[model samples]
Target: MSDEPMDAATPAGAEAAGLAPADRPIFFIHTPKTGGNTVISHFLAFLPVEQVFPPPPQLTLLDGDFATARERLPGLRFLHGHVRVTLTGLLPLERLRLVTFVRHPVRLVASHYLYFRHMPELPMHQAAKALGIADFLRRYPSYGTNPQTRYLTLALGLRRPGVHQEVSEQALAALEHFDFVGVTERMQDSLTALSEHYALPNFPPARLNEGKASRDEVEATEAVLRRDEFLMRLGADFLLRREAEERLEKWFATRRAAQARGALLQGLKGAAAMPWVAARAGDAALSFLEGWHPQGWVGEPRDGAQYWWTEDRARIVLASASGRGLRIGMHVVETLGFDPARIRVILGNRLLKTETAPAEPGAEVSFRIDAATFARHRRTAVIELAGPRSATFAELDPATADHRLRSFAVRRFTIEPLED
Candidate 1:
């Protein structure tokens, strides 16, 4: 029998090599040491040459902000860089389809150490010279300190604080805004899912470091993995097991909502009344506009009375004397996380420590503002509720109402004079 082309229609055979023509170019944020090379290599094989751009020389920093770059290079898709997701604001909220991979922190750190050892410019040896295994372990928090470290820690849920601090709370908040998170331990499975999502051909195998180390060396390094309590805590804290994945999924959703809100505020350029008005008209506008408006407005009636503003910029105070206190409640929610330096609290001429009045569960406590502090700060105060117990009035229901208490005071004030 003559050799014939294998049946192309067969269901069991390997699929054709290369992605479909209709597939859009994917923007890959190639976080370092997380199988980024493998992803790039596989993607390059199928993607058009123009679609793939080498990461910037910095490796850690992409060429420009994703949004601005995307605008300049339209039809630009598929970004592979050792950059943070927040830095790449290219993907709009609706269009974003984020995918990232994370490895075990120990493995990641080891790989990073070995990679840096070969770079003549990097002072890896000098840094490690005085540092023994124990010293290295103690300084492990430093590993996850910068953008690179933060990117990996948040993506993988690895919380080991190296000599470098792990990911900052803010960075973690940003990473949680993703749609899909692929664990590096399960590279094949993750790649398969990624291929289907992006409609690509086969995924190439990962490139392992060729440098050889003695069994003793390997054992020594692996030993660090076991003794490090922070690494262990990180693993437990992330809850990487199947059950924990569900919890992470829920957390990601909440963070995504928060990120979307933050993005909206950051995008606003001026005191454009129309945009604010439109935002206010929308459903749940009070919550969205909370801590947002310079000049506050009264919201709908609840309980018995309408929510209204009692003071102006010179001496501002929002109060809900009656009704459900929903307006004041919404105000508190917006002000809770603001930085203190951005706002000042004063009563008449004397500045008062911005303080929150504690309220019993399910009971409404009237909020009192010091006029002196308001005046000293020029009627601008960024209210923040600190501590584990203080619950925003909006979060107060019959169930969690007992947890509500005053925690922090806003001290700093950023005064933006009303434009002429």
Candidate 2:
């Protein structure tokens, strides 16, 4: 498939994929101010104007006449709006694919503040302008935390009484169902990932509903945020964003590797098999960094590629189908605040391999256990990693003084099995 997004004006993308554009419903769960406006413009290009839901006004979530709109519009397939997740016209959930984009919580909150300050047409926006950000948050605390969680999980249903933790887990669980999820920070990367699933057009967003805040203003608001509280709020959203980033990175990497080897279809097939890579909550293997012991690893995903941070030792257990002589492999890089050190890998007294960390940041170390050694623990193994020096986030940066001890994060860990 072409890396370029589909021309929104034409049905080329759908046609190329052998899908009937008229009947294939693509639901846009438009979260507020996350570069969705630009996507809407592209969606308009190919889809007939009537096929889109009730004309998205400045406030698009207006509830009324959906049944009427479905009856009126013939060949409705693309619906983009502020409404909750839903569809109609004999289209089942499988036929309809859901899509949405996410932004950083702090940035999103800051942008929302400025947006309300500038646009006072809406009663809530006018009221929000009168109240400062802190005051505004006191009333609507969801903005700072997992606002995306609420939108994705609770849409169409009234909220049952539950704490943020419960809500967050549910939201994260639900996020796996989305066909394509994008991140605002990496717009082009997100589009690239989206293209892998659907034919997206090259049309860049007009950058609609974007608000600019000076660094000082953003910093001041950030300072007011309680670190723990802010983290709790951004928890579900952060996970979702990290998953999106990893997917995009892996897509680009796979495409590059495939192009070099003249096996592009094989790369596409890998991504297709695991479209909801990080989103799956089960024990099944999916992505490179997944299937690690949850308790030992550092909290929160670090950088575009997530890894299990380890110093002296880290244990990760993976389940595999009955197979013989599976080759064990893993990818690792030096931590931000640590010196390059050799990583010692062991599986039940069997020294699979010891790999030296890369000299530079972008460079990585990939080492695999010999087939004979890997076969010993082909079903499951308590893999271990050891290094000389490790540092905490607080020690690394005084400005962000987080006290958790950290070490090298793994970008990929693989157990390649032979099909017999």
Candidate 3:
């Protein structure tokens, strides 16, 4: 990240200089558990008091209404709040530089679970009581599948709408419009990049939220377990599952090889076979063998491979392919609460609209896309089911447009020229 100061003539600095007040307030689209608070606070510190709009309560209706806020706070140069990023289109593009951050889904969810456990004022306990862990996990996709649902709706003062669509879909949609994307895992680096982008004097160290539950806390919570199970299931149905499986297989193989080498050096000539023989001779052998056999075949097992449906399986194979003009097939399976017919595929600035019929509960729906679309508009592709049956206007997060329903599972891939 560069440290050179931006001149007052520059767009960002012009807003800061109070010359031509920003046409569109600098919108900070906050994602929970993604260090949004720290980023907002840092900006508050550097920005003129009157120019800084306080972070809105989750999902408040202020997306395109900055004019009212600017009228009251004439010095306002920034409007930082929790809202859907898709709403950026509502603002004057040149004046607004959208920013947001993301974290690893597993860590984000775990952090969220802990944060809710401690904050009595937050809706976690009430939501949990109303919907127990099992029920919550089962319906979470419809309720909180989108990243927006998990954080924005509650944070921005948006009315708590009933489960509309998968929370994962909402998150992917929100990410699409961000001009600057930060990773929470590298907060300091992200902050540095932000400071450089806006030409701030210095970047402040971000404060870590305290009283966050530790790993043990997550391990102890039934909700966490359920959430993890749900995420794992989702990953399996999406591309991430394949990546995880491959990595797990590699790690297991490395460990086994190391163990075997150690045993050989220790003079255990038939050490590898000894455990199998010992287990076979004992009453506990059957159970031990059962567990060991599965553990040994960490990757796609030969027996399971036969049943493996690549089109529906969430694997990285398609995403890993090197080339432009490549075509890949994806199985849709059940559209769940969404209507298959209205699902529009958004690849960056381009929209690829397609009509699909519902598949059997576990069946796959195949769709294809060319590499040109992938390369030209591949930042993030969102599946939106927009219609009256999808969600009522009030049911939407106030910060987002009323007509849009998002999908949690986003398809991320890169494009390269195909080899001859």
Please report the candidate that would top lDDT against the real structure.
Answer: 2
At residue 104, what lDDT does model 2 achieve? 72
lDDT of 3 by residue, 1-420 (tens): 569865332246556666543254566666666777777767766677667765433334355555555455445667766554334234443455566666655555556656665677886666654654446556555323434344543443233344443344434433334445666666676676667556675556646545456756666553454555556533311222233234334444444444433332222233244332211111111011111111212146553222211111121212211223332223333233555454444332455544343443332323444555435433112222222233323355675555333231222122233333
Question: Looking at candidate 2, what is the lDDT of residue 299?
Answer: 53
Error of model 3, residue 198, in angstroms: 2.2
Model 2: residue 405 alpha-carbon error in angstroms: 15
- On residues 1-420, what C-alpha lDDT tens digit does candidate 2 reach at each position? 679855222244345666565466777778887888777776665556767765554436455655554465446667667764433222233445567787776666777776776776855687666776777777877666677666766642324224355464555555565666788888767765665567656555545554556667667766665456566667766777777677666566555433322221222235333322321112223232222323332356565446566544555443333323344445565455544445566566666654454533333554453434435544334455555566666686888876666656665655455444
How much is 286 displaced in model 3, in angstroms?
A: 62
**TM-score attained by model 3:** 0.41
- Model 1 spans with C-alpha error above 4 angstroms: 1-25, 55-60, 63-68, 84-94, 137-140, 144-149, 152-176, 206-215, 232-420
Ranking by lDDT: 2, 3, 1
Runs in model 3 deviating more than 4 A are 1-25, 55-67, 70-74, 84-94, 127-135, 139-144, 148-174, 219-229, 232-420
Q: Local distance difference test, per candidate?
A: 0.41, 0.56, 0.44
What lDDT, from 0 to 1, does candidate 2 have? 0.56
lDDT of 1 by residue, 259-377 (tens): 44443333332323222222121111212222222232235534322222211121222211111111122223223353322333433344434434333211222233444433443
lDDT of 1: 0.41
